[model samples]
Target: MRCIIMSNELTKKAAEMLLNGATLLSEPCPYCKGVRVMKDGNALCVNCGKNLK
Candidate 1:
């Protein structure tokens, strides 16, 4: 199976955002167009519970 990996810089940025209570917004979820996405641990999604990335 192929393995997906994240670079150190990307991981660091995500951690920083989480620590500062900040969230990264890339694009809207196809299922939910709602904004104000929040970060749950390493996952990001809108208040509607849609996974953004």
Candidate 2:
């Protein structure tokens, strides 16, 4: 077996979000179905206040 480590900030954050069962979406939030959604962080929504992290 082999292993690869993630060191980049974006990559690390993505991996963390994935492990936490959060979907990495660059589109609008499905909950509100609006375009006013803002990125709270690497894994959270500001509009609906959904913690993707």
TM-score of 1: 0.32
**lDDT digits (tens) for residues 1-53 of candidate 1:** 11123334345555665677877566665565534334664444433443443
Model 1: runs farther than 4 Å from truth?
1-6, 23-53
What is the number of residue pairs that collide in model 1?
0
Q: Give the TM-score of each candidate.
A: 0.32, 0.33
What TM-score quantifies how close candidate 2 is to the native fold? 0.33
Per-residue CA lDDT of candidate 2, range 1-53, in tens? Answer: 11223124334554565676655466765676422222345434434444443
Best by TM-score: 2
The per-model lDDT (C-alpha) reads 0.49, 0.45
